[model samples]
Target: MNGSKDIFSTIFSAGTFQMMLRSATPVALAAIGGSMTEHAGIMNIGMEGMILMGAFFGVLGSFLAQSAFAGLALALLVGILAGLFFALLVVRYKSDEFIIGCALNTFAIGLTTYLARNYFPGDASGNPNLPELNLAFLDRIPGLRVINHQSVLVYLTWIIVILAWLFVYKTPYGFWLRASGEKPDTLRTAGISPKKMKWIASVLCGILCALAGAHLSLGQLQGTFTDNMSNSRGFIAFACVIFAAAHPGKAYLAALMFGFFEAIGLRLQGFVSSDLTGMIPYLITIVMMVYVVVRKQRRKMKNE
Candidate 1:
């Protein structure tokens, strides 16, 4: 009974909920951005690279400028440039999106690693850690403890998610974006350029993915940009985008689901073998992917 109580307590702890939100923020942000590209008929497999670039530059800017806001701005600028470069490669040069994406990932990792080693050897792991901002008044409120002791960026992510949902579903521009993907020829006939829509989507994706990176490095990890710190969150975000069918709201839900399992894994780390605990999230992802594939197959069969 004592063991059972302990297990239950761990599962329902405030710490666990906090971990879930922290883990979910980056994935949700990136998924929202990726959804934009998918809506515009672009498969942006370079999201990981964009995120990696953002994380690296975020720390670099913060270290150089000694200000978090300046760091974030610099990261955003770099992210936009990366997006334009990706667009030029796939859209203008007719390069294969998959190959270009792989190249971009490699390029980002190599370039960032080189820069870190040469310019900021001490910060090779990232910049000085970011401090958590707490809402003091909110902390005084009973049951609002969860709302305090969190980075300001985490709160901002929630706002971004809501705004993304509104942008995708409640506006004429959203309609144009969807039309570009579902019926590009029609949109072109309507005098809306599909290419331009795709470009916009690409830029939007870059910005959001960069924010996701910023959240990971600055908000959660406190300004530490370790080599390959992205750790495939970009891919996980892609999976979230697909699982949610490219809807921002649904993507956030999917991300939360991933976060829940990730939190469980962290909680179980001391109780279970670290190796086994580490496998939980990946295993869950595989199961979810299999389920998605099976559902798609069944739907196709029904149509046939």
Candidate 2:
């Protein structure tokens, strides 16, 4: 009993909590981007591809420029181009959005793999890693250890979340985006172009998703661009957006829940089967999606 208590206590400690927050940051950032696209009525299933491209290019940029910020800038630029390509396929040509998304995912996987193999070669890891924002002075204060030694990007993510919330709820552009999804005709009548809103949303989504990928490859891992490194984080981000009904603030919370599971999986790998542990986040996503469906059905029945 004492041993079991100790194990549980260890699992619930402040260090564990910090680990969970760190794990959740990337997912939360990507989910916020996804939420923006969903709010504008665009189903961006290409998030996985965007993330992959970002990770690949981020490493490439760092390797070539030998600067983390330059790498991030390059990733963001590639993401914008990718977003524009997606917009051309889905919005302009009216290609099947789902098909285009899948193609993008496949293309990203193939292209990144080829580039890593040919150009970068030899593990294809990033050159210069982004530095952490260590606040050693804050360590003098009691109970501030957890907040002091985090990466600068993590703090930036927090600020982005708040700003995203405000952008979605308090700004006119946000209103137009929401209207584009819920009532496109109304927006058009009001002289707001739904296509333009969706384009902007797609571009912004790409930038944010790129940042998330950069966080994974540059910020957290510190230089590694493994194939499929994103590992369906894009899908999980989509789930978060759905779970939160496209609300940025709520989507951030949902992402944290997923991140918590991921953190648990990482922590439990030593004690449990790593395969089973890794499935925790995906399994939880399936369960949450089912719950949403059931709740919607029940509400429909009640209304009827």
lDDT of 1: 0.83
The Cα RMSD in angstroms, rounded to one decimal, for candidate 2 relative to the true structure is: 1.8
Report the C-alpha lDDT of model 2 over 70-109, residue by residue, as the tens digit. 8899989998998889888888898988899899989999
Clash totals for all candidate models: 3, 0
Worst 10 residues of 2 by lDDT: 265-274
User: All models: lDDT?
Assistant: 0.83, 0.84
Where does the lowest 10-residue lDDT sum fall in candidate 1?
A: 122-131
What is candidate 1's CA lDDT for residue 87?
Answer: 80
The residue-by-residue lDDT of candidate 1 on 1-304, one tens digit each, is 8887887788788888888888898889899999999898888788998898888888888888877677788888988998888888877787888898888888888998888787676755446555676668977887778767877777888888899888888987888899988999999999999888888888899999988888788778877778888888888888888778799988998888888778877897767665676566567767877898999999999999
Give per-model TM-scores.
Answer: 0.92, 0.93
